[model samples]
Target: MSSISMRKTTLAAAGLAVAGTLVLTGCKDGNEEVPAAPAAPSSAASAPADGYATPPAGGASSAAPGASAGGYDGASGAPAAGGGAVATSGQSFKIGQAATIPFTSGSKSGQLALTVTSIEAGNPADLASLNVADKVKGQTPFYIHYTAKNTGTTDLSFASVGHIKGLLDGGAESGVLLIAGKFDKCPNESLPSGFTTGKTQASCAVALAPTGAKVTGAEYWGDPYNNLNKPAQKGLTWK
Candidate 1:
């Protein structure tokens, strides 16, 4: 299979298990700390083929469009009506707010108005459809429902807008759970063909909170925001 196809297959079949502890730094809120624990091990069992990969720790492989310009609500840190203004790096927002942010996938670059609509608790029993191992299945699952729109001039078809991660209470990052095939509970998909200006798509990301913990927020660390050396800000957060 081609690299793109392989990546899609990998995303669909199973979740990516990080091999070690991850220490986050430079969080403006001073709450972006992850507890020291061994990373979840990858499951040996295979899933039925057919899904997209989780957004990589480095970045995502696809891009989406953005929302129109407007005003910023200082109190809630969200964009006002008409989609508001393009968000700067490191900005914070509330649930249901929209952030018009920039992103790049390969040679494609564009603006995407991403709205993290809600973070809902999911029943662990629903995970039976996935190929997750029992070792990690005990972790609580949270579904991050979001919408992405192309607000730029580029055609970002097949590009994914999936850099959002789940945050536990006290701001620890949650483990990502990948699904191999179609997940009816929280379906995730890539931008379809002809995803030009004004095009929009809705998707979901699965975040697994450690047993006994609760998910309270999410963070977006796409593109220049993830760059450590540059002066650009680090990431955007939402609660």
Candidate 2:
């Protein structure tokens, strides 16, 4: 080869070497990070054939429209083992030995038609009747334990059914003192129905001569009067 050609070839080789060295230097300096590839989205079609998809982000919770808000995915079936919905039976109650105090027959006019399917006393001192009646039943303040779908239906008020007659002793029925109106007397504090964690309509009691001497026997009316008898306050009333 001619000297000039040789010299040109030498320069070309040096230039290539310089370019390679610069690239090597860049790598060694760590000036640039290797770019990460974009991730592919999850495939809905690839979901498990089983009715359930993997539980939501938080264990078994996934929000499905019109379904239980959380912890419950609208899927069908009984509640999951531990981390799902829990069903509750209706509130059932039994009446203790009940006493019916008679309302003056001529005084009030109506068919006292409240029905009592079952009655049992959860506790002796405090009586609880199931499905008693309203004024139409001629029974006031009788407690009927009930269970219902959580329809958000409840009332908060005070009621007064005038002149209830209860038989304190086995003797004849006489007028029992009425307080806020529904409850005959403040229930025994020890009773479950005595107080609730989330309510204000405390049970009523007559200003009896002796403490806890509430009306007991009248064979016609240990009625469970309700607070629904009064003019509703704040538009919230219970039945």
Candidate 3:
């Protein structure tokens, strides 16, 4: 209750208030400004996670090559050059006769010749074990063996032989199947899957229907790429 004691107490209380104000000001400064996190790159953020664009319509995409829109070669059956015409001519032959046929049109320009050296009925036991077995059930399989030589500037594809056919004794025409070796000493040379120009005669085979059903006539369906429109190579008689 003394005057001196009262003055000292009041001074102490004022100093404490000032100190509290300073502490609060320091805290406000600390909270006043905070650095922001860096923003993500816009391009990467907007891009797809996998980094692939949607495929184009018509089955065409930059990601894929050589896929046909319709899943097939166009009806023209011709492919533009690399070189050559839009189509070509095909040839005919007797059972044992060999002839040099010129392909005048289409993407391939060449002298491709074929000789059907022998024809034989496929053995059922052996054929049933082959890839063609499932394809030729009910119909007998015939092995059509031939020699093919390519002597032109462009390559010729013997893979088209699947289109060749035979007329049966009953007048039914059957498409040739996969080439297979039916026996030893078949005299058929293993032909190239495709013939580059200047290649020598190569052996090839095709399977036809109705085993032991005589193949009275042989026919070629022609290579559409070569633009061949020849009539079926007919009058082919085999024993």
Candidate 4:
């Protein structure tokens, strides 16, 4: 072959060799191990759907109210013999009993024309559904119904003032009662039947709408607020 022709043949052969090598690499398959792709992250390992916040991802949280310092468990049990547990300051009532527990606050010690519309007996679980401002429905049927009228001159503020007394059997703070907690705003769980709204603690001096006077709304202060730690407000002479 001519020298020039020989050189061309050599270049052609080199080109073919490169092409063949590329083709083989492109057709890789079967057992020839290919580098595995990076695994995709999973979604399940992400945040949960429990309406609660993830701790590690941010910070921990507790469901219980932070201000839960001192309170009572109104559903502990029945009262002692003679109906005097000392929680009521010597006051006692019969089982399934109801009363018009009157109270007052403000200038003339705001008079609370209050009464237990109904009172039932049971455990804490019984007051499970009792809520304020729509937190829970009438689930806690274990409390006494206290219907109070604002027979005073000011608006009933449930928050500023706490619970006074509770229904008791034989004098113990054993009867159904509202739980206790220091509230700073409209009520949530421990509210009374007479509470018209949770916006502001109803005033104890609420004048009856019929009379166009401000009055205090009712309250079911939970636990200690019910009658444990706090002293009972000396309400107006009710009976």
Candidate 5:
């Protein structure tokens, strides 16, 4: 099968497993990169409080279109074993537990707060609901849901949905399934359109894993400052 067809099949399986049905929605087509503040010519302006140079306004993610449902190129199957958690200051959370990470500085500058409300293992029955052009074997779906709000007085760009990642035990990274407006089982209030000050929307992403994959936990990196090799923010442990 073709790569796009394979991705759509995997997405269909994941969507049904998580949402009770398939409702694909969101800005996967647009090349609109995450926004960053303009650079300054003077030496004093050269440095931003965050230390890293802002991504250019039109800069696209390194991943190509349909590269993988959630920007990964690897296919769904068993991954290499023996992975550990990424080191991070993120607090531990339980399923349905809510955690907030407030933006203290940078382009966001107190204007944004990311709230992760829940995490859960997906239902296998939902997988049966899918009508696939092809079948992806041994994979199951997991979900991470959250809300991003703009607390500032002015309108700022809100695109935190694409940045989050998921992993299984042994540090196997899951493929992110982009959800548009139709997340049936995993209802997120915000998505497609983003947040303005006092505006909040719920959104969720489905991560595909092999059946019987031991998913002991999940992680979220709201800030890019997190170490790529470890969990840099918050996580959940299934009790």
Candidate 6:
């Protein structure tokens, strides 16, 4: 299998973004860009598919301590609870729970109240609408839907805010498929105009598990948490 580098951008000075690219194997050639979909609110559109595969090579470490195996059964389609306490790194939260953590985008820095509202299972057939590789099409699909609220000062307009991944049973991370364009099933977008304090945004990431396994949880692998070289470093997880 050939190795390919997937650029994962982070904030940089002068409107430039920079971050180390992750080397992944077994990826098909050509970029997969879906046409932008109509804007919509973030919510679980459907139940996810099953199956398990090892995370991309050199991915983040295993789930942090206290991570568990389960699914969130919270009220469907409801916004996350409000005015909750901020959560620290390495802490675990459940579905529908909020975690206010440090956030950075472009040259701006602040805190965002992030909530993993649901992990909806998606049909592999959905891949037909995308230009993904065949292997990716055969794998199960999952939508990691979330909501983010800017809890700190600073307008994060046009700054990106998403570093979430699917967590399978036994602490293994799922293969995160990044589509360049909009995917209606799991649409993602950056902080809109004037995303200053008290502003909130909704987005989603696509997670693919090998046929027959399911995504049991989700994790926030922002900043130091995504340092693949530091295998000991852990990220916040939710089950």
Please give the RMSD to the true structure for each candidate, in Å: 12.9, 34.4, 32.6, 30.3, 18.5, 11.2
Candidate number with greatest TM-score: 6
Model 3 TM-score, all chains together: 0.43
Residue-level lDDT tens digits of model 4 in 19-134 = 99644533111001111123343221211111111011111112121212222343122242223121221222332232222233333233233343433333323222323313
The per-model lDDT (C-alpha) reads 0.61, 0.23, 0.40, 0.27, 0.41, 0.61
CA lDDT of 220 in candidate 6?
A: 82
Lowest lDDT block of 10, candidate 1: 28-37
lDDT of 2 by residue, 104-201 (tens): 12233111111222222222232122121121122233232211111112221111112212233333232222211122223211112212222322
Please tell me which model should have the higher TM-score, number 2 or number 4. Answer: 4
- Supply the global lDDT for candidate 1: 0.61
Error of 1 at 55 (Å): 8.7
Candidate 1 per-residue lDDT, tens place, 136-178, comes to 4567778988898888788998775656787788766776654
Quote the positional error of residue 19 for candidate 3 in Å.
90
**How many clashing pairs in candidate 3?**
12
lDDT computed for candidate 2:
0.23
Q: In every candidate, how many clashes are there?
A: 16, 30, 12, 48, 14, 6
Reference-based lDDT, residue 216, model 1? 79
187 Cα displacement, candidate 4 (Å): 8.5
